[model samples]
Target: MKYTKDHEWLRVEGDLVVVGITEHAATALGDVVFVELPEVETMVAEGDEICVIESVKAASDILAPVDGEIVEINDKLVDNPGLVNTDPTGAAWFFKLRLDDLAVLDAFMDEDEYADMIG
Candidate 1:
Protein backbone atom coordinates (compact mmCIF):
# COMPACT_ATOMS: atom_id res chain seq x y z
CA MET A 1 0.00 0.00 0.00
CA LYS A 2 1.10 3.58 -0.68
CA TYR A 3 -0.10 6.93 0.69
CA THR A 4 -0.37 10.40 -0.83
CA LYS A 5 0.02 13.69 1.00
CA ASP A 6 -3.60 14.44 0.06
CA HIS A 7 -4.46 11.46 2.33
CA GLU A 8 -5.48 9.02 -0.37
CA TRP A 9 -4.06 5.48 -0.22
CA LEU A 10 -3.45 2.90 -2.91
CA ARG A 11 -2.92 -0.83 -2.78
CA VAL A 12 -2.02 -3.01 -5.74
CA GLU A 13 -3.85 -6.33 -5.59
CA GLY A 14 -3.00 -8.39 -8.62
CA ASP A 15 -4.35 -6.30 -11.53
CA LEU A 16 -6.57 -4.09 -9.40
CA VAL A 17 -5.60 -1.14 -7.23
CA VAL A 18 -7.62 -0.32 -4.11
CA VAL A 19 -8.09 3.31 -3.09
CA GLY A 20 -9.27 5.08 0.09
CA ILE A 21 -8.49 7.87 2.50
CA THR A 22 -6.24 7.19 5.49
CA GLU A 23 -7.67 6.42 8.93
CA HIS A 24 -6.35 9.79 10.04
CA ALA A 25 -8.53 11.51 7.45
CA ALA A 26 -11.63 9.51 8.33
CA THR A 27 -11.22 10.43 11.98
CA ALA A 28 -10.87 14.06 11.11
CA LEU A 29 -13.96 14.00 8.87
CA GLY A 30 -16.18 13.19 11.87
CA ASP A 31 -19.17 11.06 10.75
CA VAL A 32 -19.47 10.35 7.09
CA VAL A 33 -23.06 10.85 5.91
CA PHE A 34 -22.86 10.19 2.21
CA VAL A 35 -20.60 9.25 -0.69
CA GLU A 36 -20.62 10.05 -4.40
CA LEU A 37 -18.53 7.81 -6.60
CA PRO A 38 -17.90 7.98 -10.33
CA GLU A 39 -19.42 5.25 -12.46
CA VAL A 40 -17.49 2.14 -13.31
CA GLU A 41 -15.37 2.24 -16.49
CA THR A 42 -14.64 5.94 -16.10
CA MET A 43 -11.11 7.02 -16.91
CA VAL A 44 -9.36 9.30 -14.42
CA ALA A 45 -6.02 11.03 -14.30
CA GLU A 46 -3.77 11.32 -11.28
CA GLY A 47 -5.05 13.94 -8.81
CA ASP A 48 -8.48 14.12 -10.39
CA GLU A 49 -11.46 14.33 -8.06
CA ILE A 50 -13.40 11.17 -8.68
CA CYS A 51 -15.73 11.05 -5.70
CA VAL A 52 -17.12 13.12 -2.89
CA ILE A 53 -17.31 12.11 0.74
CA GLU A 54 -19.71 14.15 2.82
CA SER A 55 -19.31 14.14 6.57
CA VAL A 56 -21.12 15.93 9.36
CA LYS A 57 -18.33 18.44 9.54
CA ALA A 58 -17.43 18.89 5.86
CA ALA A 59 -17.55 17.47 2.38
CA SER A 60 -14.31 16.39 0.73
CA ASP A 61 -13.27 15.21 -2.70
CA ILE A 62 -11.76 11.74 -3.00
CA LEU A 63 -9.00 11.98 -5.57
CA ALA A 64 -7.61 9.45 -7.97
CA PRO A 65 -4.04 8.93 -6.84
CA VAL A 66 -2.91 7.51 -10.16
CA ASP A 67 -4.14 7.44 -13.72
CA GLY A 68 -6.53 4.51 -14.04
CA GLU A 69 -9.97 3.22 -14.94
CA ILE A 70 -12.54 2.91 -12.19
CA VAL A 71 -13.48 -0.73 -12.14
CA GLU A 72 -15.42 -0.95 -8.87
CA ILE A 73 -16.60 1.01 -5.87
CA ASN A 74 -17.69 0.26 -2.31
CA ASP A 75 -21.46 0.31 -2.81
CA LYS A 76 -21.84 -0.33 0.88
CA LEU A 77 -20.83 3.27 1.53
CA VAL A 78 -23.93 4.60 -0.15
CA ASP A 79 -26.13 2.79 2.34
CA ASN A 80 -23.88 2.98 5.36
CA PRO A 81 -21.36 5.76 5.12
CA GLY A 82 -20.20 5.28 8.69
CA LEU A 83 -18.10 2.42 7.37
CA VAL A 84 -15.71 5.12 6.23
CA ASN A 85 -15.22 6.22 9.81
CA THR A 86 -14.90 2.68 11.14
CA ASP A 87 -12.81 1.12 8.41
CA PRO A 88 -11.34 3.68 6.07
CA THR A 89 -8.56 1.39 4.96
CA GLY A 90 -10.42 -1.90 4.94
CA ALA A 91 -14.03 -2.70 4.17
CA ALA A 92 -14.70 0.99 3.56
CA TRP A 93 -12.30 1.43 0.66
CA PHE A 94 -13.83 3.89 -1.84
CA PHE A 95 -12.91 2.25 -5.11
CA LYS A 96 -10.54 0.09 -7.13
CA LEU A 97 -8.53 1.21 -10.11
CA ARG A 98 -7.01 -0.69 -13.00
CA LEU A 99 -3.86 1.40 -12.77
CA ASP A 100 -2.38 2.87 -15.94
CA ASP A 101 1.14 2.29 -14.64
CA LEU A 102 2.00 0.46 -11.44
CA ALA A 103 5.16 2.55 -11.16
CA VAL A 104 3.08 5.62 -10.24
CA LEU A 105 2.69 4.21 -6.74
CA ASP A 106 6.41 4.68 -6.08
CA ALA A 107 5.92 8.45 -6.02
CA PHE A 108 4.04 8.28 -2.73
CA MET A 109 5.44 8.24 0.79
CA ASP A 110 5.49 5.23 3.10
CA GLU A 111 3.48 5.01 6.32
CA ASP A 112 6.23 6.38 8.53
CA GLU A 113 6.74 9.44 6.40
CA TYR A 114 2.98 10.12 6.26
CA ALA A 115 2.61 9.78 10.02
CA ASP A 116 5.43 12.22 10.67
CA MET A 117 3.96 14.74 8.25
CA ILE A 118 0.52 14.69 9.91
CA GLY A 119 1.95 14.84 13.40
Candidate 2:
Protein backbone atom coordinates (compact mmCIF):
# COMPACT_ATOMS: atom_id res chain seq x y z
CA MET A 1 0.00 0.00 0.00
CA LYS A 2 1.11 3.57 -0.73
CA TYR A 3 -0.08 6.77 0.95
CA THR A 4 -0.48 10.31 -0.27
CA LYS A 5 0.27 13.59 1.48
CA ASP A 6 -3.46 14.25 1.34
CA HIS A 7 -3.99 11.21 3.58
CA GLU A 8 -5.32 8.92 0.87
CA TRP A 9 -4.07 5.31 0.66
CA LEU A 10 -3.63 3.19 -2.45
CA ARG A 11 -3.56 -0.57 -2.63
CA VAL A 12 -2.76 -2.47 -5.79
CA GLU A 13 -5.27 -5.29 -6.42
CA GLY A 14 -4.77 -7.37 -9.52
CA ASP A 15 -4.40 -4.76 -12.34
CA LEU A 16 -6.42 -2.10 -10.51
CA VAL A 17 -5.56 0.28 -7.66
CA VAL A 18 -8.01 0.71 -4.81
CA VAL A 19 -8.26 4.17 -3.20
CA GLY A 20 -9.44 5.23 0.25
CA ILE A 21 -8.76 7.79 2.96
CA THR A 22 -6.46 6.70 5.76
CA GLU A 23 -7.66 6.07 9.30
CA HIS A 24 -6.09 9.39 10.24
CA ALA A 25 -8.28 11.13 7.72
CA ALA A 26 -11.42 9.33 8.88
CA THR A 27 -10.76 10.34 12.48
CA ALA A 28 -10.23 13.94 11.48
CA LEU A 29 -13.51 14.08 9.63
CA GLY A 30 -15.55 12.85 12.59
CA ASP A 31 -18.59 10.70 11.71
CA VAL A 32 -19.32 10.47 8.03
CA VAL A 33 -22.97 11.08 7.12
CA PHE A 34 -23.00 10.79 3.37
CA VAL A 35 -20.72 9.86 0.49
CA GLU A 36 -21.09 10.84 -3.16
CA LEU A 37 -19.20 8.43 -5.35
CA PRO A 38 -18.11 8.81 -8.95
CA GLU A 39 -19.59 6.84 -11.81
CA VAL A 40 -17.95 3.63 -12.84
CA GLU A 41 -16.20 3.81 -16.24
CA THR A 42 -15.56 7.55 -15.89
CA MET A 43 -12.07 8.66 -16.94
CA VAL A 44 -10.22 11.09 -14.74
CA ALA A 45 -6.86 12.80 -14.40
CA GLU A 46 -4.79 13.28 -11.28
CA GLY A 47 -6.21 15.89 -8.89
CA ASP A 48 -9.68 15.92 -10.40
CA GLU A 49 -12.52 16.00 -7.87
CA ILE A 50 -14.21 12.62 -8.22
CA CYS A 51 -16.31 12.11 -5.10
CA VAL A 52 -17.79 14.04 -2.19
CA ILE A 53 -17.83 13.01 1.44
CA GLU A 54 -19.99 14.73 4.06
CA SER A 55 -19.21 14.27 7.70
CA VAL A 56 -20.37 15.81 10.96
CA LYS A 57 -17.48 18.26 10.68
CA ALA A 58 -17.53 19.23 7.01
CA ALA A 59 -17.90 18.17 3.40
CA SER A 60 -14.80 17.12 1.47
CA ASP A 61 -13.97 16.03 -2.04
CA ILE A 62 -12.07 12.87 -2.88
CA LEU A 63 -9.66 13.54 -5.69
CA ALA A 64 -8.34 11.22 -8.34
CA PRO A 65 -4.84 10.21 -7.31
CA VAL A 66 -3.72 9.33 -10.83
CA ASP A 67 -4.80 9.34 -14.43
CA GLY A 68 -7.12 6.38 -14.86
CA GLU A 69 -10.57 5.04 -15.52
CA ILE A 70 -12.82 4.39 -12.52
CA VAL A 71 -13.77 0.77 -13.08
CA GLU A 72 -15.68 0.22 -9.85
CA ILE A 73 -16.90 1.96 -6.68
CA ASN A 74 -18.05 0.87 -3.24
CA ASP A 75 -21.80 1.44 -3.41
CA LYS A 76 -22.13 0.35 0.18
CA LEU A 77 -20.66 3.69 1.31
CA VAL A 78 -23.77 5.54 0.14
CA ASP A 79 -26.03 3.56 2.44
CA ASN A 80 -23.65 3.33 5.37
CA PRO A 81 -21.27 6.23 5.41
CA GLY A 82 -20.01 5.28 8.85
CA LEU A 83 -18.19 2.40 7.19
CA VAL A 84 -15.55 5.00 6.43
CA ASN A 85 -15.01 5.47 10.15
CA THR A 86 -15.23 1.79 10.99
CA ASP A 87 -13.16 0.30 8.18
CA PRO A 88 -11.39 3.07 6.35
CA THR A 89 -8.52 1.14 4.86
CA GLY A 90 -10.57 -1.89 3.97
CA ALA A 91 -14.23 -1.87 2.95
CA ALA A 92 -14.29 1.95 2.87
CA TRP A 93 -12.24 2.14 -0.31
CA PHE A 94 -13.99 4.62 -2.60
CA PHE A 95 -13.05 3.32 -6.02
CA LYS A 96 -10.82 1.10 -8.10
CA LEU A 97 -8.73 2.77 -10.79
CA ARG A 98 -7.38 1.19 -13.96
CA LEU A 99 -4.26 3.19 -14.73
CA ASP A 100 -2.29 3.50 -17.91
CA ASP A 101 0.90 2.79 -15.95
CA LEU A 102 0.86 1.37 -12.45
CA ALA A 103 4.52 2.43 -12.28
CA VAL A 104 3.37 5.98 -11.49
CA LEU A 105 2.58 4.73 -7.97
CA ASP A 106 6.29 4.74 -7.13
CA ALA A 107 6.07 8.53 -6.65
CA PHE A 108 3.85 8.15 -3.55
CA MET A 109 4.93 7.52 0.04
CA ASP A 110 5.30 4.20 1.79
CA GLU A 111 3.52 3.47 5.10
CA ASP A 112 6.60 4.44 7.15
CA GLU A 113 7.04 7.70 5.27
CA TYR A 114 3.34 8.51 5.62
CA ALA A 115 3.46 7.84 9.36
CA ASP A 116 6.47 10.13 9.72
CA MET A 117 4.80 12.89 7.71
CA ILE A 118 1.64 12.77 9.83
CA GLY A 119 3.66 12.81 13.00
Candidate 3:
Protein backbone atom coordinates (compact mmCIF):
# COMPACT_ATOMS: atom_id res chain seq x y z
CA MET A 1 0.00 0.00 0.00
CA LYS A 2 1.04 3.58 -0.66
CA TYR A 3 0.29 6.54 1.61
CA THR A 4 -0.37 10.25 1.21
CA LYS A 5 0.82 13.10 3.36
CA ASP A 6 -2.78 13.87 4.18
CA HIS A 7 -3.05 10.51 5.99
CA GLU A 8 -4.89 8.59 3.27
CA TRP A 9 -3.77 5.23 1.88
CA LEU A 10 -4.31 3.63 -1.53
CA ARG A 11 -3.40 0.41 -3.23
CA VAL A 12 -4.02 -0.90 -6.70
CA GLU A 13 -6.59 -3.69 -6.91
CA GLY A 14 -6.88 -5.07 -10.43
CA ASP A 15 -8.56 -2.28 -12.48
CA LEU A 16 -9.29 -0.04 -9.51
CA VAL A 17 -7.70 1.46 -6.43
CA VAL A 18 -8.76 0.97 -2.83
CA VAL A 19 -8.65 3.91 -0.40
CA GLY A 20 -8.78 4.51 3.34
CA ILE A 21 -7.39 6.68 6.10
CA THR A 22 -4.13 5.47 7.69
CA GLU A 23 -4.19 3.56 10.97
CA HIS A 24 -2.60 6.53 12.70
CA ALA A 25 -5.43 8.73 11.53
CA ALA A 26 -8.15 6.32 12.67
CA THR A 27 -6.56 6.04 16.08
CA ALA A 28 -6.30 9.78 16.39
CA LEU A 29 -9.92 10.24 15.41
CA GLY A 30 -11.13 7.94 18.22
CA ASP A 31 -14.29 5.95 17.53
CA VAL A 32 -15.89 6.77 14.20
CA VAL A 33 -19.63 7.39 14.32
CA PHE A 34 -20.36 8.25 10.71
CA VAL A 35 -18.69 8.31 7.31
CA GLU A 36 -19.77 10.43 4.37
CA LEU A 37 -18.59 8.83 1.17
CA PRO A 38 -18.47 10.17 -2.36
CA GLU A 39 -21.07 8.96 -4.76
CA VAL A 40 -20.18 6.37 -7.37
CA GLU A 41 -19.14 7.97 -10.69
CA THR A 42 -18.06 11.15 -8.91
CA MET A 43 -15.08 12.74 -10.61
CA VAL A 44 -12.40 13.82 -8.17
CA ALA A 45 -9.11 15.64 -8.37
CA GLU A 46 -5.94 14.82 -6.56
CA GLY A 47 -6.07 16.34 -3.07
CA ASP A 48 -9.83 16.79 -3.23
CA GLU A 49 -11.92 16.26 -0.14
CA ILE A 50 -13.92 13.26 -1.31
CA CYS A 51 -15.19 11.91 2.00
CA VAL A 52 -15.63 12.79 5.63
CA ILE A 53 -15.37 10.63 8.76
CA GLU A 54 -16.91 11.85 11.97
CA SER A 55 -15.59 10.47 15.22
CA VAL A 56 -15.94 11.11 18.91
CA LYS A 57 -12.95 13.41 18.72
CA ALA A 58 -13.75 15.36 15.54
CA ALA A 59 -14.67 15.19 11.88
CA SER A 60 -11.89 14.81 9.32
CA ASP A 61 -11.69 14.93 5.54
CA ILE A 62 -10.43 11.93 3.62
CA LEU A 63 -8.76 13.28 0.52
CA ALA A 64 -8.38 11.64 -2.85
CA PRO A 65 -4.82 10.36 -3.14
CA VAL A 66 -4.80 11.08 -6.85
CA ASP A 67 -7.15 12.18 -9.62
CA GLY A 68 -9.83 9.56 -10.18
CA GLU A 69 -13.49 8.70 -10.50
CA ILE A 70 -15.08 6.96 -7.57
CA VAL A 71 -16.27 3.53 -8.57
CA GLU A 72 -17.49 2.13 -5.25
CA ILE A 73 -17.94 3.06 -1.62
CA ASN A 74 -17.96 0.88 1.49
CA ASP A 75 -21.69 0.57 2.08
CA LYS A 76 -20.97 -1.29 5.30
CA LEU A 77 -19.76 1.96 6.80
CA VAL A 78 -23.27 3.34 6.87
CA ASP A 79 -24.18 0.86 9.57
CA ASN A 80 -20.77 0.07 11.03
CA PRO A 81 -18.69 3.19 11.16
CA GLY A 82 -16.68 1.73 14.01
CA LEU A 83 -14.95 -0.41 11.44
CA VAL A 84 -12.85 2.63 10.69
CA ASN A 85 -11.28 2.21 14.08
CA THR A 86 -11.41 -1.56 14.36
CA ASP A 87 -10.00 -2.45 10.94
CA PRO A 88 -8.93 0.69 9.18
CA THR A 89 -6.80 -0.82 6.43
CA GLY A 90 -9.05 -3.72 5.69
CA ALA A 91 -12.81 -4.03 5.22
CA ALA A 92 -13.28 -0.48 6.45
CA TRP A 93 -11.88 1.06 3.27
CA PHE A 94 -13.88 4.12 2.28
CA PHE A 95 -13.89 3.69 -1.50
CA LYS A 96 -12.50 2.27 -4.70
CA LEU A 97 -11.23 4.61 -7.40
CA ARG A 98 -10.81 4.08 -11.11
CA LEU A 99 -7.64 6.13 -11.44
CA ASP A 100 -7.59 8.83 -14.08
CA ASP A 101 -3.84 8.28 -14.51
CA LEU A 102 -1.89 5.63 -12.69
CA ALA A 103 1.25 7.73 -13.05
CA VAL A 104 -0.17 10.21 -10.55
CA LEU A 105 0.50 7.67 -7.80
CA ASP A 106 4.23 8.31 -8.08
CA ALA A 107 3.70 11.33 -5.84
CA PHE A 108 2.77 9.20 -2.83
CA MET A 109 4.85 7.41 -0.19
CA ASP A 110 5.46 3.71 0.29
CA GLU A 111 4.63 2.24 3.69
CA ASP A 112 8.18 2.45 5.04
CA GLU A 113 8.62 6.11 4.17
CA TYR A 114 5.20 6.88 5.55
CA ALA A 115 5.95 5.08 8.79
CA ASP A 116 9.19 6.99 9.35
CA MET A 117 7.61 10.30 8.43
CA ILE A 118 4.78 9.77 10.85
CA GLY A 119 7.13 8.55 13.58
Candidate 4:
Protein backbone atom coordinates (compact mmCIF):
# COMPACT_ATOMS: atom_id res chain seq x y z
CA MET A 1 0.00 0.00 0.00
CA LYS A 2 1.12 3.53 -0.82
CA TYR A 3 0.11 6.50 1.37
CA THR A 4 -0.06 10.25 1.62
CA LYS A 5 0.81 12.21 4.74
CA ASP A 6 -2.90 13.08 4.81
CA HIS A 7 -3.52 9.38 5.45
CA GLU A 8 -4.96 8.33 2.12
CA TRP A 9 -3.78 5.12 0.45
CA LEU A 10 -3.58 4.12 -3.17
CA ARG A 11 -3.34 0.67 -4.68
CA VAL A 12 -2.75 0.06 -8.36
CA GLU A 13 -4.65 -2.81 -9.88
CA GLY A 14 -4.44 -3.18 -13.63
CA ASP A 15 -5.50 0.16 -15.18
CA LEU A 16 -7.47 1.29 -12.17
CA VAL A 17 -6.23 2.75 -8.90
CA VAL A 18 -8.12 2.18 -5.68
CA VAL A 19 -8.15 4.93 -3.03
CA GLY A 20 -9.12 4.92 0.64
CA ILE A 21 -8.31 6.39 4.02
CA THR A 22 -5.69 4.46 6.00
CA GLU A 23 -6.49 2.69 9.27
CA HIS A 24 -4.65 5.37 11.16
CA ALA A 25 -6.81 7.97 9.46
CA ALA A 26 -10.07 6.34 10.45
CA THR A 27 -8.94 5.85 14.00
CA ALA A 28 -7.96 9.48 14.16
CA LEU A 29 -11.27 10.59 12.70
CA GLY A 30 -13.31 8.55 15.19
CA ASP A 31 -16.70 7.14 14.24
CA VAL A 32 -17.45 8.02 10.63
CA VAL A 33 -21.09 8.88 9.96
CA PHE A 34 -21.18 9.95 6.31
CA VAL A 35 -19.20 10.12 3.09
CA GLU A 36 -19.56 12.22 -0.02
CA LEU A 37 -17.98 10.78 -3.12
CA PRO A 38 -17.18 12.45 -6.39
CA GLU A 39 -19.18 11.50 -9.43
CA VAL A 40 -17.74 8.91 -11.75
CA GLU A 41 -15.86 10.40 -14.72
CA THR A 42 -15.07 13.59 -12.83
CA MET A 43 -11.59 14.83 -13.61
CA VAL A 44 -9.58 15.58 -10.49
CA ALA A 45 -6.14 17.07 -10.05
CA GLU A 46 -3.48 16.08 -7.63
CA GLY A 47 -4.14 17.62 -4.21
CA ASP A 48 -7.76 18.35 -5.06
CA GLU A 49 -10.44 17.60 -2.50
CA ILE A 50 -12.42 14.87 -4.18
CA CYS A 51 -14.46 13.48 -1.33
CA VAL A 52 -15.51 14.18 2.23
CA ILE A 53 -15.56 11.73 5.09
CA GLU A 54 -17.62 12.91 8.04
CA SER A 55 -17.04 11.39 11.41
CA VAL A 56 -18.85 11.98 14.67
CA LYS A 57 -16.12 14.42 15.57
CA ALA A 58 -15.57 16.27 12.27
CA ALA A 59 -15.62 16.23 8.51
CA SER A 60 -12.36 15.48 6.69
CA ASP A 61 -11.45 16.05 3.09
CA ILE A 62 -10.25 13.15 1.04
CA LEU A 63 -7.58 14.55 -1.25
CA ALA A 64 -6.56 13.16 -4.57
CA PRO A 65 -2.88 12.42 -4.24
CA VAL A 66 -2.70 11.67 -7.96
CA ASP A 67 -4.18 13.55 -10.90
CA GLY A 68 -6.86 11.37 -12.43
CA GLU A 69 -10.43 10.86 -13.52
CA ILE A 70 -12.73 9.12 -11.12
CA VAL A 71 -13.94 5.88 -12.62
CA GLU A 72 -15.87 4.44 -9.69
CA ILE A 73 -16.86 5.19 -6.11
CA ASN A 74 -17.79 2.92 -3.24
CA ASP A 75 -21.48 3.61 -2.79
CA LYS A 76 -21.49 1.39 0.24
CA LEU A 77 -19.86 4.16 2.23
CA VAL A 78 -22.79 6.50 1.80
CA ASP A 79 -25.11 4.11 3.55
CA ASN A 80 -22.69 2.63 6.04
CA PRO A 81 -19.94 4.99 7.10
CA GLY A 82 -18.88 2.62 9.87
CA LEU A 83 -17.43 0.50 7.11
CA VAL A 84 -14.69 3.08 6.97
CA ASN A 85 -13.96 2.43 10.59
CA THR A 86 -14.29 -1.31 10.17
CA ASP A 87 -12.28 -1.88 6.98
CA PRO A 88 -10.65 1.29 5.81
CA THR A 89 -8.40 -0.37 3.26
CA GLY A 90 -11.04 -2.61 1.79
CA ALA A 91 -14.80 -2.14 1.76
CA ALA A 92 -14.58 1.51 2.74
CA TRP A 93 -12.57 2.56 -0.32
CA PHE A 94 -13.59 5.98 -1.59
CA PHE A 95 -12.96 5.63 -5.27
CA LYS A 96 -11.09 4.05 -8.14
CA LEU A 97 -9.33 6.42 -10.44
CA ARG A 98 -7.70 6.16 -13.85
CA LEU A 99 -4.50 8.08 -13.21
CA ASP A 100 -3.22 10.74 -15.56
CA ASP A 101 0.33 10.74 -14.21
CA LEU A 102 1.82 7.64 -12.70
CA ALA A 103 4.76 9.66 -11.38
CA VAL A 104 2.60 11.14 -8.64
CA LEU A 105 2.57 7.76 -6.95
CA ASP A 106 6.27 8.26 -6.22
CA ALA A 107 5.49 11.30 -4.07
CA PHE A 108 3.51 9.18 -1.62
CA MET A 109 4.72 7.07 1.32
CA ASP A 110 4.96 3.29 1.21
CA GLU A 111 3.11 1.10 3.71
CA ASP A 112 6.02 0.51 6.10
CA GLU A 113 7.00 4.16 6.11
CA TYR A 114 3.42 5.25 6.61
CA ALA A 115 3.02 2.78 9.45
CA ASP A 116 6.14 4.20 11.08
CA MET A 117 4.80 7.71 10.72
CA ILE A 118 1.45 6.78 12.25
CA GLY A 119 3.09 4.72 14.97
Top candidate by lDDT: 2
Q: TM-scores for all candidates?
A: 0.96, 0.99, 0.95, 0.94
Alpha carbon lDDT of each predicted model: 0.90, 0.97, 0.89, 0.89
Name the lDDT value of residue 48 in candidate 4: 95
- Where does candidate 2 have its weakest 10-residue lDDT segment? 56-65
Best first by TM-score, ranked: 2, 1, 3, 4
RMSD values for the candidates in order, in angstroms, are 0.9, 0.5, 0.9, 1.1
Best candidate according to TM-score: 2
Q: What TM-score, to 2 decimals, does candidate 1 have?
A: 0.96
**Cα lDDT tens digits for candidate 4, 1-119:** 78988898999878888999888889999999999999999999888988998999998899988888999989999999999999998888999999766666887788889989988
lDDT of 3 by residue, 30-95 (tens): 999999989999999877988888998888888887778899999999899999989999989999
lDDT of 1: 0.90
Clash count list over all predictions = 0, 0, 0, 0
After TM-score superposition, the amount by which residue 28's alpha carbon in candidate 1 deviates from its true location, in angstroms, is 0.8
By lDDT: ranked, best first: 2, 1, 4, 3
